[model samples]
Target: MPFKTLLFSKQDTIAVITLNRPPMNALNSKVYKELGKVIDELNEDSSVKVVIVTGAGEKAFAAGADITEMVNLSTTEMHEFCLISQDAYNKFEQLNKPTIAAINGLALGGGCELAMTCDFRLASENARFGQPEINLGIIPGGGGTQRLPRLIGLARAKELLYLGDMIDAVTAEKYGLVNKVVKQSELMNEAMAMAKKLASKPAVAMKVLKNTVNNGVEMNITSATNFETNSFLVTFSSEDRLEGMKALLEKRKPNFSDK
Candidate 1:
């Protein structure tokens, strides 16, 4: 299917979704709608073991939401838009395969929120991040208020949200908002290399690992530990588990079936 607001392509077992509203790839209703559809397709695709999301150009991963469209929206319309955007992002986050955000430039407001939905982020030296909704006399409506604190500490998250100031990629990495930062010229290469490495791992174990960590972090310690235990036990039933152990003993690479 064709997407008006994005570009989708697959490279071997890795897929890439590029936000395509060039000059700034601002998130809007159309972008959200297209994104939802694309995520659905990718989730159903068994061949795609990992996904990499980034902006079309170097200037921005997404500068922010489309202010031109939001400037005159009624309160009810705004609510609907937020809900739709949240739904789209939820799809992205819930994907069974790992997702990485390759942030090349500005990631502000909804852009920051979008990157947060990924399993992790890899940033370029030129990348900039912020939750600057307060600058527009508004606040983050797309899980920012929740996920930001969960990533960084409460105090740091508050500083960014309250001040609406942009942070350089180095500061973002220091705050643990991004996994790593590389030179601008190496961003895509680094991201794709990581994605390929992940794709080559035992798929079923990777999926279970992702699920365990994502769900466990939101639960109490006791419950999270029990959940992890159950997940670990379940992996023993998978064919990959047997292959993984057998390959270890045989000193050969495991060919996981994701079973």
Candidate 2:
């Protein structure tokens, strides 16, 4: 299906989704609706190997939600709106395939939440980030509260959310909010390169590893170890694993039927 607020392309097994509103690309209900639909489509399509998300303009990946529209909603309506946004973003985060958020510029409030929802994040030197909902007498209603604490420590998450102050990309990297900060011109190229490398790997093994890492923190040591043990057994029995081993023995690149 076609999209109104997003532009999607496929290259070298990576599905790139660009937020095309430009000039900050503030997300609204329509953007969330389209995003939810697109994400569902990607999840259903086995042909797509990886997903990359970025904004169209140089000014911001997404400055935040469309505050002008948000201000008009009643409290109940606002809660419902936030729930909708969370559903869409959680879909991106919990996708079986890995996702990368390439922050080209300011990623504040909902925008920051969106990037945090991805499996990994890379930002440009010109990028900035914040959870500035408190500045408006509100708070981050998306997955910010949970995801932020998980990424950085709870103390740092509190400082950023409570202060509602913007931090530079370098600071964000230092605080472990982002994986890396690159030159503005090289951000997408670098992100795509990483995406391509990931796409080349066996799909089920990648997803299983993602689940293991994500679930590890929420589980006890013994439980997490059991999960890892099961995952190890599962991977050993997979066709991809056999193919990978055989390719090593054959001294050739593996042709992953993704079996």
Candidate 3:
């Protein structure tokens, strides 16, 4: 399908979704819907081992939500709109496959929330991030309040949200907001390179690993370990496991079937 606000393409096992609106790709209802569609495709397609989300241009990953639309929204309308966007983000987070957020530039407010939803975050040296929603007399309604704390720490999350200050890429990386920061020119190359590396690994194992790691964080330690152990056992029962073992025995690279 043709996308209105984003570009979706696959290379080998990586699916890249570029937020196509120029300058800073601010989120809109259309953008959210388009993203939701692509996210759904990533979830259902076995060939898609990883997904990379980024903005089209160098200005921003996403500046924030479309505040122009927000001006007209009543409290109820605002809730509905935020829910739509949050639902898309929730879908992205729940995806069994791994996802990497390519923070190309300024990732503020809902933009920051979007990146936090992903499994990993890689930022360009020119990137910036923050939850600057309070300046507008509002709080982030799109999972920021909850996710930021979990990502960094409660104190750090509170400091960022309370002050609504934007931080540089390097600072963000130090605080655990971003995974790594590279030169602007190397941004896409680095993201795709990492995606390719992850794609080369056993796809089914990555899915199971991602699920156990992500879900385990919310559960107690004992339950989480049990869940992970169960996943370990489950993988050994798969065709990919057999191939991985046989390939090791034959002294060759394993070719996974994602089964």
Candidate 4:
């Protein structure tokens, strides 16, 4: 299937989804619809061990939502739009494989919300981040209000939301908004390299590892620990676990079948 608002490609076990609305991949109805479709396909793709998301061109990952298309929307329509957008983003957030947002440029408004959905973010030196919807007399319609504080601290999330100011990649890293910052020229290369490394690991273990953290974080300590213990036992019963332990004793590399 062809996409009207995005570009999708696969490299071995890695799938790359680029927001493709030119210099600024502004989120609009088309983008949201296409993104939902893409994510559905990726979710069903067993061969894809990791997913990397970035924006086309150099100037912006996604400047923001498309205001021109949104300016005249009725309150009811806006509500529906927000739900559609959030649904698509949430699907990507819950994808079984690990996801990395390669933030190459400005990731403001909905872009910032999108990045927070990823397992982690790798930003280029030129990357700038913000939740500037307040500048337009609105607030974040996506998951920013919920996810931002969870990623950073409460105070920092408040500052970004209230002030609606853009922060440089270094500042974003300092605030724990991004994992690392790299040269703009090296962003894709570095993202692909990291994705490939993750791809080579035992897929079942990776899935279980992600599930342990994501599911455990929302529970009380005792409940979370119990969940983790049960998850560990689940993995302990896998063929890959046996192979991994046997390989360690045998002094050989383990070839996991993702079982």
Candidate 5:
């Protein structure tokens, strides 16, 4: 299906999703709806082992939510709106395939929240990140408050949230908000390179790794270790594992079927 607010393309095992709202790519209800649909499509496509998300232009990954569309909502309407946004983003975070956020420019407010949902974030030198909802007399209704602290640290997350300030890509990298900062011109190339590398890994094991880490973080050490043990057993049963081990002894690269 075609999308009104997104551009989607697939090259080999990688799928790229571009937020298409012009200039700043301010996410609105339409964008969120289309994003949910796109995520659904990618989730069901077995051939797509990795997904890369970016914006239409170099100016912004997404500046934020569409303020014009959000400013007049009643309290109840706002609650429903937040729930809708959360649902869409949650689907992205829980996707079966790994996702990479290629942040080319400004990623603010809900934009920052969206980036956090991805498995990895590769930011360009021109990229700026922040949770600036406080300046608008509101808090981050997205997962910012929850995920930010977990990604960086409580002190740093609070500082950014309380100050409503934007950090440069280098600063973001130092704070652990981004995996790496590349030149703006090379952002997409770097993202595609990383995506291809991830695609080449054992698919079943990769999925299990993502599941374990995401779920384990919220569990106690004892329970998390037990969960990891179960996950290990599950991966051990895969044909890829047998092939991997056999290939090691045979002195050749393993051809994983993702079984």
Candidate 6:
């Protein structure tokens, strides 16, 4: 299906979704709906091994949610809007294939949360990040409150949320909010290269690895280890696992079928 708020394209096994509201790509109800649809399409497409999400313009990945649309909304309407946004973001978080956020510019409020939903983020040197809802007399309605602390730390997350201050890409990298920062011209290239590398790995193992890390982080060490053990055991029955071992011994690249 065609999208009004997003531009989707696939290059080999790598898929890219660009937020297309130009000037600032502010998130609104329509954008959320379109995003949810796009995520569903991508999730069902087996050929897409990796996904990259970014903004359309040079100024912002998404500056924030659409304030004009929110300013006049009643309490109940705002709550419904937030729920939609959360659902869209949750889809990204639960996707089986790995996702990379190419943060080309400002990532504030919902923008920040959107990037956090991805498996990891790679930012341009000019990119900026923050959860600035406090300035609007509200809190992050997206997953910011939860994911931010998990990605960075409680203290640092509090500082950004409470102060509503934007941090530079270098500072964001230092806080562990972003995996790496590169020149603006190199941001997409870097993301594409990383995505392709991840795509070339054993697909089943990669999915298991992501699940283990994501689920394990919230569990106690023993429980997490047990979960990892079970996941590891399940992989033993996969054809890719056998091929991987055989290729290692044969001194050739493994041709994983993602079985």
Highest TM-score scorer: 5
Task: Record all residue pairs in model 4 with backbone atoms less than 3 Å apart, i.e. clashing.
Answer: none
TM-scores of the candidates in the order shown: 0.98, 0.96, 0.97, 0.98, 0.99, 0.98
Model 3 has a clash total of 0
As for lDDT, the candidate ahead, 2 or 4, is 4
User: What TM-score does candidate 3 reach?
Assistant: 0.97
Off by over 4 Å in 4: none
lDDT of each: 0.95, 0.91, 0.90, 0.93, 0.95, 0.94
lDDT tens per residue, model 3, 169-194: 99999999999999999988999999
lDDT of 1 by residue, 27-70 (tens): 99999999999999988888999999999898999998999999
Candidate with more favorable, higher TM-score: 3 or 6: 6
Q: Write the per-residue lDDT of candidate 4 for residues 164-238, one digit (tens) a residue.
A: 999999999999999999999999998998999899999888989998998899999999999999999989999
C-alpha RMSD by candidate, in order: 0.8, 1.3, 1.2, 0.9, 0.7, 0.8
Error of 4 at 21 (Å): 0.1
Give candidate 2 regions above 4 Å deviation.
none
Instruction: Give model 1 RMSD, 1 decimal.
Output: 0.8
Q: Name the runs in model 3 displaced over 4 angstroms.
A: none
